[model samples]
Target: MKRFFSLPNEIFSLGLSPGALALYSYLLYCEDRKTYQCYPSYASIGKSVCMSVNTVRKYVAELEGRGLIITEPTSVITRDGRKHNGTLRYTILPIRNAVDRYNQRRLRQLEETVERMRIRKKLEGNEEHPA
Candidate 1:
């Protein structure tokens, strides 16, 4: 909501879209709440987090595009229940580094998408941009 993203701006001295932050928060929670520090494959992570693989892939792409996380694809277990040979790599940026980069990049993308609104204004204007 407007209240949540607004808090990041006030606390971090940078901007973060709700979606970008949701991805970051998930990574952080995986670390802080569940102690998952190793990189997570998109599919496994999706299952673990209870989000659809498509949603995970979408958010992971957003995180990578924002430089909040670095991602790579490997052959992971296929959908047919065969354990494949590879998996995707998702490296979360360090929190300190990600804070600024995620915000800055998200702000830039938001500026582009906002259509005649300042990034902050646009964010304040919408509460439901998802992860």
Candidate 2:
């Protein structure tokens, strides 16, 4: 079955690098509804995003740092009792929190701007009215 993931516009507002955005998109594409996560190898992710494995790792780290995703190192054991490292499990975070943060920052900036304007208007009025 073909799977699709919904990406919100807040991604653009997040200011992620191009590579990070591509990696994020691929991760979203790979998300399994049942698990709410994806575990693609770095090489596979690189191939999908047209980036090198190292580049994929770099961007994935960036995403993790930005709180857009969470990753956990995992391992698996084979039938022969051999232990091997498995793909990194990634949990994509809902963008609502990020969106709220962005909105709060924007609102603060706007408030500051309005305050500055009000102060300037008061100063100008004082200068003109000799008060």
| lDDT of every predicted structure (CA atoms) | 0.60, 0.88
lDDT by residue for model 1 (2-96), tens: 32212234324445455555656666555423332446666766666677778877877776765556765666576787876566555655456
Off by over 4 Å in 2: 101-131
Model 1, position 26, has a per-residue lDDT of: 62
Candidate 1 off by > 4 Å: 1-22, 29-37, 74-85, 102-131
Among all windows of ten consecutive residues in candidate 2, which has the lowest summed lDDT?
94-103
TM-score of each: 0.45, 0.74
Give one digit per residue, the lDDT tens place, for model 2 in 33-83.
777699999999988889999999899899887778899999999999999
